[model samples]
Target: MPKKLYNIDFYKFIESLDLHSFTVTDVTRYLFETYSKEFDNKKNATQFVYRHLKRLSKEGIISAIQGKSGKAIVFRWCTESSEDSELVHRTEIYGNKTNDLIVSQLQEKIRRYKTEMLMSVGETEAYSEWVQEMPDFAEYVKPHYQNTREQAKLMLGKVKGFERLLAEHEARLS
Candidate 1:
């Protein structure tokens, strides 16, 4: 799938453009002139603008106005719909660097906790079976098994907390 590029920079760039209608070529030229460092070449920059224009049109962020000849497509920045503007704002917030960092950290913590829980469960089960067959070794193995169980419980608690935090963040975004 094509990577979505509705990032803060893109949002700001689109916002900076004139409200009047513009052709893809006009937008591409403007982008190349204004932010040449962002694109490797004019061709790539033009492609990026084309894709962005199509996406924005689909999202109702911009309206495409067909010209007289039917060959020219002029795009005008659209803000007539409050819902579309709100969606754009929310998208910007979700793509913010701080939110991205928090999301990454939460995902990492959740993954680590899940792995630890699986390992703890495996160890505890092994110890339980070993203790059942060998009662003489129960005293030595029981403590370790108990420790694993406790660790697993703690991990589960942490996982639940992280999940709640993530859900709250998502709710706020929505």
Candidate 2:
């Protein structure tokens, strides 16, 4: 059976926001713990996040609820349109343009293909060539796991290097 890919972006957007009104301290904690969706800065907190949250209010995703004494702003999730669901009867607010399901699927496919390629190509040199392509391959793959698929098709569009390497390994073993 095939695995179902979930739409995480709608949830991600909700996760990114401050559900309740927050002061400087609460905002800091929210940014640090829950959402890495970029609150102006991931590492530092200052007027940047506060300012941006204010801007978000203008976009209708958040509303600045002014109480009697303390000014507390509660941000609401805009569930308007099929973007969130078919149940939205309100105005559109702060949903992103596209969901992250596609990006996640693409990455998963790439990973599965790479694993298959490694099993098929049976030589260190061929594997090494493939692993050397990604800009962040070193960080992504473990230290012991070294394989890549960048040294691509020949002028004839065949994976000649990989085939040659695999054959060389076979011949040596024989």
Candidate 3:
């Protein structure tokens, strides 16, 4: 027998938390701790959890019960007899929208980073070329050239990381 394939679903995770009320902070901590593989860091985990919380509230699956107290907004799941089907429908719709938003944002970041990367490339070239053509200033320009090259390397890593995430998200959608 072969094992079945499975992917972690954020909506399902939220639904599994059978709590009467919960705050975004609480959920974020739990999510970040439990799904360390899915998220790169706590900040990303918090953002993902927050996005779903807002969507769930908008869909009436959850309602805000706090925040008027000047504290974290707590949410309560609205349980009803028809919740299963309705929950599935609402989450499915909102989930796709959320995913689409994430994809678009990632694309924008990739574009911005690529632009910066190109600028860094030009700076790196200019600095290195200046060092050879103007040997008297090489001592001062060498450090700048090395710094620009290092920055370009870091930006390339970030671009690759974003591309990997984009691919994973697209694959999940299909």
Candidate 4:
């Protein structure tokens, strides 16, 4: 039941803003504070704002300029349309085979797998320490330790495979 940013009226959000130009961080913080219940967390708010900004740029309502730091992007409101401007949604954006949703979903999966792998590593270490402290319990702890290590290995493989797939998908889109 996650809230998707594409469903929100981002065009109206942009129009309501007083700033002519802003970075994603600025918009993310504003939205996170204004729509705390909807977003639930800063990360979710940031992703929602970033997606909307990208869609705005794509629709020509805003222009993305290079920021002082070469890697940073700044979005400037380029159009002076009336209040009834057409709302920009992800319907068009997600129509393509390789879209933001797919890329973000893949990245989220990779992050989850990496996190689980790290947790598994921690569990393996704890089990190793327990076994060293009490050799008599080695027989009981061996299965758990081995299973955690194997799961960590499996997670690593999954992460690498997904990363490769993501790269190939991005390359194809490019």
Instruction: Indicate which candidate wins on TM-score.
Output: 1
TM-score order, best first, reads 1, 3, 4, 2
Model 3 segments more than 4 A misplaced:
1-86
Model 1 agreement with the true structure over 1-174: per-residue lDDT tens digits:
674352336555766775478888888888899887767788877788888889878766779999878997998877653556657666775578678798889889999998999899999999999999998999999899999999999999989999899889878867
Worst ten in a row by lDDT for model 4: 83-92
- Kindly give the stretch of ten consecutive residues in candidate 1 with the minimal lDDT sum: 3-12
TM-score of 2: 0.29
TM-score of decoy 4: 0.47
User: Candidate 2: lDDT over CA atoms?
Assistant: 0.46
- Residue-level lDDT of model 2, residues 1-174, one tens digit each, is 553332234324444563545444456565555544544354444354456567656655555665555665444444431344522322322222222343444445555555555554444444455568764665555343433223221211233444454456446545
> TM-score per candidate, in order?
0.54, 0.29, 0.50, 0.47
Q: What does candidate 1 score in Cα RMSD to the true structure?
A: 6.5
For model 4 the local lDDT of residue 165 reads 92
**Alpha-carbon shift of residue 139 in model 4 (angstroms):** 0.6
Best by lDDT: 4
Stretches of candidate 1 exceeding 4 Å from the true structure? 1-19, 26-60, 65-71, 80-108, 167-174
